[model samples]
Target: MRFRPLRSTPTSSPTLAMVAEPPADMRAVVIDRTGPPEVLHEASSPVPRPVMTELLVRVVAAGINPIDAKTRSGKGLSQAIAGYPAVLGFDFSGVVVQSPYESHPFPAGTEVFGMLPFPRTGGSYAEYAVVPTLSVARKPTSLSHVEAAGVPLAALTAWGLVVETAHAHEGQRMLIHAGSGGVGHFAVQLANYFGAHVTATGSARNASWLRELGATTVIDYTSTRFEDVVADVDVVIDLVGNVHSDTGTRSLGVIRPGGLYIVVPTHSFPGYAEAAAEAGVRTTGYRVVPDGSALATVGRLLDSGAIQVFVDRVFDLAEAADAHALLEEGHTRGKIVLRVSDD
Candidate 1:
């Protein structure tokens, strides 16, 4: 993968210097094997110490991603698990408990929210999560812990696709499939923020909500064929997999040549890569990285009400199994979160 030239050099703030460390033996949700969410079990595990550029956070909540359950259910992510007794979770909101680098901006009490790359020991579904300082962002003051927890994976995924992958610009025409799903809603708002002329595909029930998020047009995926009504797009963020393979594959029809089609779950989709090539379109899948700086920016945006977080459900850590079941249903709007500790 190519790296973008650094837009700005990293800056240090007082918030970066104040994070604290956790004591050993904290309560955390863990999995011994991959199968069902039932595989995730509560365990008293050693609280990890942050290394250079890492911060230990006292987790208040963890965001649930569809991929999280996919990994649990032995799908695309099963091999990503190294062994049993694995901790599973990525997005988290918490207070900074410790930092190895004194130049840190998040002081011991500073509340922060962000995503961790998967397969790490510092799982977010615990009393504490260890995050690379780069991936951690200060939580937006206007949002509650549960709300902040929901932002990282889905929101960042949207940001990565709309802003980074597709390079969506103001007045550009864009289409977001599954506009009511966790990542789709954020794509609508973020793309709109960039001045894109946005169209979103979702159920008729979410049309008004999509409009509120800045979708200029909303297609009821159930009642209308998107290809039949949509055309001439600069970008398409495909969130649905084979379930809408025809729509996803034919999405190329809408893109102007030199346009982009980004599929979140197409890694396992049959002929996805080949289809993109045949259509003369550029397409790629992505895995989210820890970007503390981006999170901080998102926090500021949240505080200003430029973006809104949608929570479909919140479950206690003990109910993580139930949470995964809900996610597996595949129709949830916005995000599902788990309350770990407290605010």
Candidate 2:
């Protein structure tokens, strides 16, 4: 599906209208009960209003992260969304329809994209959303709405781990597992940008692509063990979670003493942290929180050609079920986005 790009120049803005109020109900992807993808229902919900520190945005597109589907399957949802009827999505791009204050960075009609507050609302899979002002930023001018929609969650997760948490600096060596996955791909580029020598692990077919994305070394995890290939690494960013605990444990062996190993998946293994400690390395388990400032930082990088956005696939909003199915296969190259109509 094709999308109309948001005009990013000062004189060029999106041609969206401003009305006194929106309709009482709007279309949304609602999970009435947590089960499978088939249980997801499309229904009408109230058009959310902008409260203090919030902006009401008309969603042009929403990005699908693997965790969104995971949480929907009764795996990640907590008491925050324990009720049956729930909205599921975190990353989105759209026009700011209204804001609580006039001094808002995103005034009415500003084009923006970022990760919304998760668990508490998870309402980005809708025609409109009420998001905190600090949780969003001006959308990148170089990308279309659908492409920009793909940036928030996965990209930020990669950035926060490589740049913020691990502080992977120049002349350092790092290894990233699952180099072709959403977060893995970004982690590769970001690490390289920080002047680090990056080694990444993926299938044989993805090795060339990973190199093009700035991976100094690419390992086909299918044929060889990455730990056996890389040694004395400064950092290891593991995105495969507990499902690959052994790989995470082995990652510590590659990092030198006092280096860092950061885990990006849900649960942290008891032995993984202990092994890192035993090896005289630091270990951290992270969960991403919404950060608009980071989005602005990323937007500037994108605008200056410092970073690139990787979109593995685009699905229409109605084909959300198919998108989730593809992501569940565990081999998506980059990010998957759901394109919504301007009407």
Candidate 3:
């Protein structure tokens, strides 16, 4: 993981010139060996210098996602990691402290938020992070750093599933599983905002809340089997796969013939394609990619209050293990975020 040095700093910002540079090394929660949550411990890591079109961001907060827990347990993207002492985080909200070049659109001191393609590169579980210029957008003026941190990866995933893949539109009927979860909550809102009729599955406790997010029908998974009640839907966004129950396979039976069944987690099921084929429905797997342009559009929607991001809890950087523990319990209403540095 060698990086080229930034020969030219963003000197155009007078404030940037006056401020001292970031520390050479920073405090980060890291794991030398993948294991349980307790494996995450504090360590001093070199503050990465941005190269090429990258920018150095002083991370104010980082969002916790299910993938973080999976990777920590030697699953998910853990195989993609090149070495030990890996820092795992995907979504971040922070200030740009170093730009690829002077006079860049997002210069030093500019507030931004985005997701990192972790393992392929370093991640956000640190005080400072290396961010691609095109992977970030100006943070929404309406959200604080903690709130903003919760948006990127989850929102992008939902946007990709609902709008980009399903083409959510008027009269389109969509079923969203785990509707109160980090990505599920966003899926419900984006589908409704795009004029789709939403039916969501969640606990009875979350039923009213999911309705508030625009789900016309909220199925309590504890009380009712979703496949029995939901049928002939235009799209089914399955956040929970057959790993928990027969969710992925059962979801196929609900979608109308030719309807799309989008599976979010590949690790959750083994043979979804064969299941969807037998059920006579079209299917696809989805993975969220960082997109500043789409994120910028999402920022606009956020600022306008057309959609909302719910932060279920906030933990300090050192409490990353606790955050991961909560995530594994699978009951979080929205997103859980780690406060890395003060905004």
Would you estimate the TM-scores of all the predictions?
A: 0.90, 0.91, 0.94
The lDDT values for all models are 0.83, 0.83, 0.91
What are the per-residue Cα lDDT tens digits for candidate 2 across 1-343? 9999998657564433343467788888888877777776677888877677788888999999988888878787544685657788999999888876656667777899987776676478889988898889999998888888988888888889988898878998989999899888888999999999999999999999999999999999889988777899888898875574478877888888898888877764666778778889998888886889998898898888888888889887777878888898888898999886582
Q: Give the lowest summed-lDDT range of ten residues in model 3.
A: 11-20
What TM-score does candidate 1 reach?
0.90
lDDT of 3: 0.91
Better of 1 and 2 by lDDT: 2
RMSD of 1: 8.1
Best by TM-score: 3
lDDT per residue (tens digit) for residues 208-297 in model 3 = 999999999999999899877878999999998888788888888888889999988866878888888888888899989799999999
Minimal lDDT window, size 10, model 2? 11-20
Full candidate order by TM-score, most accurate first: 3, 2, 1
- Tell me the tens digit of each residue's lDDT in model 1 across 104-179: 5766777889887668555787897778778888788899999999998888888878888887787899999999
Once superposed on the true structure, which residue ranges of model 2 sit more than 4 Å away at CA?
Answer: 1-20
Clashes of each: 18, 0, 0
The reply for model 1, stretches above 4 Å from the true place, is: 1-21, 101-103
Model 3 C-alpha RMSD to native: 6.0
